[model samples]
Target: MKQKTIGLLGGCSNVATAEYYRFLNEAVNTRLGGWEIAETLIAGMNFGNIEAFVRTGDWDGLGRYMKTKIDGLVAGGADVILCVSNTLHKPLEDLMDRGGVPMIHIADPTGVAMSAAGLSKVAIFGTKPVMEMSYLKDQFQHRFEVQAIAPTEEEQCDIDQIIFDELVKNKLKDTSKARYLEIADRMRREEDAEGLILGCTEIFLLIDQDDRPDFPMFNTARLHCEAAVDFALS
Candidate 1:
């Protein structure tokens, strides 16, 4: 069987994309039981452009720019493309409609995992844009038949700050991680969430199951990379 080449649009934080690269290659090697790694192509994007689009509400312009960039990856032999950012998944359809390459959505795998685990509800952590955007949450809810919930207004602000201020810069503070854990607990208690989603690719840097052993945590970057590698090897 021929392996599909994985193409990635990364650097939404630079940190997240790097994690995706690591996780995808690691997963491929583990599954193949050798030094095997994915044949990957990456088209990096500046975080500034993404922020500008969100700030200025110029999604159309952002879509055009991403579509053009992804075209480069497709031309370079990318069989499948991954946007690689939870926030950027908002403009996902625009790029996918180009029909140049098959695009892997970030939330789809999470939804699938949730459904398989019989989790009825999950709380997501990410930037303001990711939390505010209902499309991603809807995909999880409608497609997987699970309730996808976001943080409270205060929690959203803090999580957004943690992603932009510390996580993106590769900084890790136990205090901030603890705060995130607290919020997840609140979601479980108040909303009856069965699991937690580290939706922002950068969030996995600070929090994981190690910190909260009792809680079921879904690391989006890791899960997305696993899905990418599965597609490549399929």
Candidate 2:
């Protein structure tokens, strides 16, 4: 059998990218056994450029940057492409539309996991733009009859501070974990959410199943990585 090649469009911040890479290799090795590792093509871009494009919502600039990344991946013999950042995925649809490469949409696997978990309503925690925009919610709603709940304005700012300023920079603080757990508790109690979806990849850095003991937590990073491993192995 030919070795499958997967492409990763990462470096939105190196932390999430590293997580994806580690998750892919670990999942593949664990499932297949032995020291066999997954083949991957990575194009890590400059964090400054990615942040600038994301802050300004420059679709053209983002598409251009992604194109360069994808070009390198394809040239390196990647069969499928996956973007490591959920926020950066805003421009991904357009890029994949024109690029003719099979890019896995992270939300699809997340919806699958949520559906399998028998969750009717899930609270989404992410940056302000992803929470405010209807992209992820609409996608999930169209596929499944799931309600997507977001954090309040104050909570959004809090998440932004933790994710962008701290977690993405690889500075994990115990206080941030407590704060996220508090927000998760509120969502479960007030929103009546069946599960919590860590919509932002960076969220995994702060909170996990240990923090949200009252409700099931869907780690998007793990979900995305599982899908990528499946695609690569298939």
Name the best candidate (by lDDT). 1
lDDT of 2 by residue, 1-234 (tens): 355788999897799899999999899999888887789989999988987887787868888988998889888888888898878778788878877679889888989988988888988888777788888888889997778889898988898788888988999999888888888788888889888888889888788887657688888888888898888877
lDDT at 74 for candidate 2?
A: 82
Cα deviation at 31, candidate 1, in Å, is 2.1
Model 2 gets an lDDT of 0.85
> For model 2, what is the error of residue 20's alpha carbon versus the real structure, in angstroms, after optimal superposition?
0.9
Clashes per candidate (backbone, < 3 Å):
0, 0
lDDT per residue as tens, model 1, 198-221? 888888778888877878899888
Q: What TM-score does structure 2 among the candidates reach?
A: 0.95
lDDT, each prediction: 0.86, 0.85
Q: Candidate 2: misplaced stretches above 4 Å?
A: none
